[model samples]
Target chain A: MSDIDVAMARALLLARRGPSSDPNPRVGCVVLDDAGEVVGEGWHEGAGSPHAEVAALARAGTAAHGGTAVVTLEPCGHTGRTGPCTAALITAGVARVVFARPDANPDAAGGAQRLRAAGIHVSQIEDLGLRTEADALVARWQQAQDLGRPVVTWKFASTLDGRGAAADGTSQWITGAPARQDVHDLRADADTILVGTGTAWTDDPRLTVRDRRGADRPQQPRRAVMGLRGLRPGSVLERTGATVLDTRCPHEALRRLWALGSRHVWLEGGATLAAVFWQARLVDHVVAYVAPAFLGLGAPAVADLGIGSIDAIARLRLDDVTRLGDDLRLMLTPTPDPTEGA
Target chain B: MSDIDVAMARALLLARRGPSSDPNPRVGCVVLDDAGEVVGEGWHEGAGSPHAEVAALARAGTAAHGGTAVVTLEPCGHTGRTGPCTAALITAGVARVVFARPDANPDAAGGAQRLRAAGIHVSQIEDLGLRTEADALVARWQQAQDLGRPVVTWKFASTLDGRGAAADGTSQWITGAPARQDVHDLRADADTILVGTGTAWTDDPRLTVRDRRGADRPQQPRRAVMGLRGLRPGSVLERTGATVLDTRCPHEALRRLWALGSRHVWLEGGATLAAVFWQARLVDHVVAYVAPAFLGLGAPAVADLGIGSIDAIARLRLDDVTRLGDDLRLMLTPTPDPTEGA
Candidate 1:
């Protein structure tokens, strides 16, 4: 790998330390002295915080003079609550700058051009080897920005035979404790947790991220229920201050969620809701926890998505397979169908 | 490891080379000289062929005198088509004999006692570390002999959602080529392939073992269908000379299969039959090939097995998980429930 790739990987790791629920993209910066030694590093904490370049420059002090700054995202040229990061780097006397991903937001883009205009050397991390890691640092934010909607991740826990609940609807537990903890982790990473009104009425899930001891985490994702039917009057969702989308169409619900500043949506379904999202191709990622048990009769994990024959089956590429206790967690993404129009 | 353990492991490997469909146990023998160097190796060919000990003895000739004989199974004292292996070993003048597993068949057991009575130094492979490996060598045959029924292995191919077919009943294939080939390999290892009459009438599957190139293997397992209803007229089963076990009970079907000399029975089902076997606790082993695809509506891989709640779920311990092309092959065994009586 090139020197820039190594610095960008470190920058990505630092970026992950930032709050994922923030509307703004996470960014990390590393400032190097003239001798190619890292002098300072900083990551954006959340919205209204100092930009990564400004934070790094403050830590670097005089070492920023004639030095290089490596960042996970391009230094912003447009000012928001804080001044433009390009001006900060220029004022700090940094001679060279390297970035992993270019800022795609129209309002904050063109930092690379501004740096070049100021006669400072600017380069992007162009190594193909570091592209995936670099892109993943801001993949969900980038996707949400590109599509004008929250990136949806559909999650479910089911038996080996794909039953989500038993015949009598008693599904208190399907996956083991470890898998459930992993799901809580997933919930904590998202900006919103969504379910259908049917789930809200039938299950009345608290929809709160919790620790192993069952204590609710401080920064819980915003809970929301979609569909025209209203939740039960005494439902847990009503007590938990969850938003009611009041729309049967998945597109409208996602649009409202995007408007509500939800960049990533965790979709917990009751089969029928999942089918609608899948049928409309709204699901971006799938996380399935399959327990090594057989419930020969129960609610199927997913309802019909208009598939009638084998040729119409929804194919997914298995990205990762992990064993969490006795349950197998499968991470998958839909493979693009050549027969379907974009 | 002990020298005897190494020799017995080699003997087990040689034993596996014999035809699994043979009524007699596959036994291998290795004759070691006084210097602990192998002088000869032999495995029983089939029923009419010489026993493993006699074959090794014939190859050892004069070298057998004052040497050691390592066999996978105890040398038989009574003979059917050949002279007693004990008599042959005594004539060969072997000083010591080590066997991995004792013969359990009533007609052929007591070989160890006979060898001791003849004043030969007899030793059994008693190493705890090699017990599982040794037991697996003859597990199916021994189980059949002990239970008076064939050892049943239930095999099925399904989508990740536990679907066996599409909504339109069009399921030409669920798993990929590699998983299908693995199923054929499983069929080749079993003595019989049993399905329900409903499957025979609906699918009319050609239950024959075949190679990768679509050529029928010379040694195919016996195909049989069990149910009260008769098979459809002029089905593939009729053309393939499959037997009809006209009984709805899983126990009766297994009993008839045992009477027909089936030691290992591979149960390939179309949902209902699998549920019956599982409900009866007749499924000793399970092999599930899960394709990384979703069929939202289809025939489930298994029907209702009388479980109404999560507490009644049939749990299994995953023994092995393997990736076959794009599909996953899971090998599992039933976990004993403490609440249920044996």
Candidate 2:
């Protein structure tokens, strides 16, 4: 097999890893013989498991000796879940290593450096397509590592006129069933569903993942209630099992959630809470669902972010625009302002 | 010629009409001989001009006899600025009449019916593609004829948070230059720009079409001020050409504008005025420009539209969504409520 064949094999092995990898990057490895024939293949299943290279080396046995290791991500040089993959490759007597994307995690980065120092031929795959594909698989984990907290995704559904509810506070349904199902799909990707105490207590929502037919999902995200306000004993969130954090500060709540192993936080808080996170520049992503209907007067999707003038207004980089039923779903990320000294 | 060939020829002839053909539907015509050879072609130049079919017939002369007349729109039976196109085709001894779109204007729609009654072979082109193209060319005029009033397109530019102005009314430029330039292009298509007394007296905007370089357009729309408030001395609109209407009712103002030969009206009024037109269902279309900025506290793009509940909220059919600079422009048309007995 050629280099292209090895890269294709690595990509296939990477995709074999299911959507269960969290906190750690999803990586795949393939051991190739001297003639570039794939001998063994393995992928990182989840956290607290053997790294891809180590798993592949164990399967390859003596066949891994003098073999080239083709991987989606750079093998880790540090010990976290299992031993460092670099040491494992070296112990297995691998002759060469070819990886797609460079590991951005500071702790796990120096794998190529270690391999080269050990006289193993190490090459970073320069294919832009393969690198982009590998990077996207670990984008959320990389974001969490860079921010030192769970990546926050604020999801909101509102009327086309920007109203979250009617004048009389009737907001039982703003988006259609399709958009609601999309929200559930979004929640499935997150490990934690966060809401302010005001929402948890006032709306008393059961923040549980459910399908369009109202059937509970097999994998459910933990419900988290932030802010100083306390939840009532018989509240829906309290009864449905929620972690109550008595802090109004967004950073503190995010720190606690990160400590609880949450890599992605889905924020379903009210407008005021969203504004607080937005003003603090803690929101990583924004997902807005705009219904075709117009309620001229009602609660706004975002309120009072301390923006007084045009220059102070926040800007977001639009990523995707999709239509679901009669509603539009906009995916955006906050554009970092250079003036803010980020 | 084949129907496809004639349809394509008619489309090209329609495209020959200049952009200044306002207050009237642009139309094109072609005459084909018995041997499928093109005899003559013509397009409506502007308002007060001879209809396309008449001009084509005059050019064809005796060649039009026993030939087929192919037109973008069903030839008119009622005369406006010139003689009826139906009478011209009959006098020219045309054997068959084939048109792309049926004339929606009640006053001019009886041409096909009369041609059929005269024992002439008449057929409406059933090609959906050609009909759609022809209908789009005269969409606003057809809408005006259907509603018995000038087509109202409410265009408003706002911050991404749906604010028209800051709390202190400092909204000089919410969107960037590109979006503002796009708005001027939109204004150039309308014959009149309507605003309420509040907007006229407060903002005092010079409602004129200008290019990005601030050069005035050759054709400027009439700035119309509705409502009873008197304009201050030396107001911008008063100094620039403007028409003052005492009635605040959107329907009455539209009717008066229609009688003045205005076919399309761009409403640049304030939120209250916009709500009035929206609630009355007088707004035929909406052009919203959402800037990627946030003004936490400010005037909303629209205010209290007499809707208290979610079910009563107005629904608009979205037509186009485009990004102009950092602004998102949404083009929507008001969907008539069946309950209102359209």
**Top-scoring candidate (TM-score):** 1
Candidate 1 has what TM-score? 0.90
Q: Give the number of the best model, judged by DockQ.
A: 1
Clashing pairs in 2: none
Structure candidate 1, residue pairs in collision: none
List native contact recovery per candidate, as a fraction of 1.
0.82, 0.64
lDDT of 1 by residue, A1-342 (tens): 756677777888888888775678888999998888888888998777987778888999999899999998888877443237898988998999998777878888888888898889998888765556767878888888887889889998988888999999999788889999999988988889999999988887999999989899877888999998987887888876799999989999998988887889999997899888888889989999998889888999978878888888888998888889988999999887645885
CAPRI tier of model 2: medium
TM-score of 2: 0.87
Residue B37 error, candidate 1, Å? 7.8
- C-alpha lDDT of residue A162 in model 1: 86
